[model samples]
Target: MKTVFITGSSRGLGLEFTKQYLEKGYLVIASCRTPEKAKALHDLKMQYSDTLSLIQLDVTKEKERDRAFDEINEVFDSIDILINNAGIISGDGKNLYNLGDVHKEDFMKVLEINSLAPLLMSEKFLPLLEKVTNAKIINMTSQNGSITQRTQGGKYSYCTSKAALNMITKILSNDLREKEITVLAIQPGWIQTDMGGVNAPLKPAEPISKIIELVETKEIADTGKFLTQEGKELPW
Candidate 1:
């Protein structure tokens, strides 16, 4: 069975990804910042005990990243897929804000979690990812990242962070091309999740299912593209 590692799997899209991948017979390593508090993830772990491995991970912390890598590497020889799904929107970016009123620390925090952590995780796990023949690194990005599609002005911190993530996806895809690891920045649409909000028209399940399909079917030739959940290529 293929092995997949997912960050932020305590809730939202990450938890859903863990559940579905386990159903598909993949050995899933689901990590969250607080595993003791993740009731939903615990429930899924109980149901899929044999295939699911739960670990505590705080994507922003380098120490935690190294520890998690050591733990996972000891048990799993290789990872066929690594999903960089952890992210955050700062309070200053939660809604429309005056440019001058946005908190500098909060903005930096958002960038650290939403942009830098994924690239760091990819770097730390590249060795394990390289062990598998058809390896992939899926960066959970947003269409808000698209420089060409920017029409609105608010959400400065969130938008710019995602844009940085888009650049990381492109660079990593280029760097890993010879290793046969396909890298993709997937826009999962505005789904009904904690991050996406309740008013979102798209549900998490449909978009996630479609995303898995794209992940499974996409060839190396399709790497480095920013794609929608529906498989449409978006403007970078």
Candidate 2:
């Protein structure tokens, strides 16, 4: 069976991805910082049993990342696809004045978790990933990352981190091309997750199912693109 490693699988979009992939017969390595707190994943584990395996991971922690690499090394041959599904939003970034009032520490924390850690994970696991014939690294990015669209302009931390993630995606795409791993960024649309909020247009299921389809059909030429659910490439 094909294997996938997904970060932030404790809840929201991550949980959904774990559920869907397990149903499709892929062995899923689901990682979250707090495994006991992941009630949904806990329930799914009881039902899915053998396919879904939980591991402790907090991207901000290097020790955790190394431990995860060791775990994956022991559990499977190599990951066919890796979904960097972990992300965070500034609870303070709702309006303009809110940006000024935001704590610098919180902003740095978000960047560490959202932007830098994924790069670290990619670098650390690159060797193991090299074993897969069709290796893929999917960075979960946002339309907010689009330099072309500014909109109302409040979420400074979230927006800048995702934009940086896009740049990292491009850099890795170029770097990994010769290595045979496909590095790509995807905009999962405004799905109704904890971060996306209730008013968000589509449900998590909609964008996620579409993303899986895209991953299955992902082409060599599709690298470095900021793509949307409908298969249209969004502007970087």
Q: Which residue pairs does candidate 2 place in steric collision? A: none
How many residue pairs clash in each candidate at the backbone level? 0, 0
The TM-score measured for candidate 2 stands at: 0.95
For candidate 2, which ten residues in a row score worst on lDDT? Answer: 91-100
For each candidate, the alpha-carbon lDDT, in order, equals 0.92, 0.86
User: Lowest-scoring 10 consecutive residues by lDDT in candidate 1?
Assistant: 89-98
In candidate 1, stretches whose alpha carbon ends up further than 4 angstroms from where it belongs are 91-98
For candidate 2, give the lDDT of residue 116.
Answer: 94
Cα deviation of 115, candidate 1, in Å: 0.6
lDDT of 2 by residue, 1-236 (tens): 88899999988899889989998999999999999899999899999888988999998798999998998899788888989989988634543324566667777877887899889989988987899886999999998888888677577878888999999999999999887788889889888888888999888887898899899988557777789877798888
Best by lDDT: 1
Show model 2 residue runs off by greater than 4 Å: 91-97
lDDT of candidate 2 at residue 155, scale 0 to 100: 77
